[model samples]
Target: MRKSLAVLVSGYALAGLAHAMAPAAPEPDAPRTAPQAYAGLGVGLVDYSGGGSKASPKLFGGYEFTNKLALEAGGIDFKKGYGLYIAVKPTVPLTEKLSVYGKVGVAKSRREILPIAALPAAPLVRKNDTGAYGAFGLQYSITPNTVVTAEYERFGKKKESGAKEDVWTLALKFFF
Candidate 1:
């Protein structure tokens, strides 16, 4: 009876130890959250259709309403002109750190042309135009609040001179 009692106590202790050593069950998935609003500045080289490329600068800001949708506004100096644009950006995430997006928007552009040295009699020309624009880009998140992008954008033809423009840019953005 004494030996049986000792064996039973030892078995109970070992069972309790096993229970304590077991891994806990996995927790349920957490709810998803959208990114916060952000603002950024970008500078890049703009390639003009008519000739050479030039340095371009931009200021932009936006809010992400969801993981896939956002609204943005920006001002850009596109070499020969300057424009203000508002766009809807729809994004598709390929991974936690990478995404592709499309931009569709309208812009108001103002262009100024100075008289050429060969044409002394030519006056300075100023024109204002409004048009639709589109862009597609790949954004790679470098951190929670910073991203880098490579994009191609096209602007509609100028109403006055029937000129169109395109640019390829690499940009860095920081989110607030």
Candidate 2:
């Protein structure tokens, strides 16, 4: 009887230890919409790859209308030129801290070209063009409200041999 009592106590202790080591179930319905709307401004090199690079200051704002659809706007250079785009992104959460998305949108560029003094009699020309833009980027969310992203964008526009202007840009972005 003494031996049996000792075995039973040891079994109970071991069972309690097993129960304590089990992982707790995560809470359900914890909210996941924090990455929805993001707004930020970034000052970076705006490379017109084929044209010329400039010190570009841009304002960016995005609203995630749904998990897959978003509308984003960027205004740059004292609003001399602005881009408004609506895109559908395939977003996949790679980890708790990072995500990847790809988007395709249509963009328009409008700019005022100052008349050169050499051609003082030349009329001022304000050029406007419309094109499509596609972007692919990786985003890191340090916190729910802070994010940094690097994107490669291709803006498709072409100018004739003697055409007035050609504009395309690639940039990196940061959002808070």
Please name the candidate that would achieve the greatest lDDT relative to the true structure: 1
Instruction: Note the residue pairs that clash in candidate 2.
Output: none
Which parts of model 2 are misplaced by more than 4 Å?
1-31, 48-51, 65-69, 78-80, 114-120, 159-176
Q: Taking the tens digit of each residue's C-alpha lDDT, what string does model 1 give over 1-176?
A: 99999999999999999989998643332211556687877875665544556778888888888768889888778666786778999989888788899999987777766567699899878777778978899998887678898887766564433124565667777766
Estimate the overall C-alpha local distance difference test score of candidate 1: 0.75
Local accuracy of candidate 2 as per-residue lDDT tens digits, 1-176: 99999999999999999989988643442224545676776653444423455655656777776544566766555233444455556666778767778877776656555566699889766667688767777776655556677666544465322122222333344433
For model 2 the local lDDT of residue 13 reads 99
**RMSD of each candidate relative to the true structure:** 12.2, 12.1
lDDT of each: 0.75, 0.58
Q: What is the overall TM-score of model 2 with all chains considered together?
A: 0.59
Q: Tally clashes: model 1.
A: 0
Give the top-scoring candidate (TM-score).
Answer: 1
Q: Could you tell me which residue pairs clash in candidate 1?
A: none
CA displacement after TM-score superposition, residue 20 of candidate 1 (Å)? 27
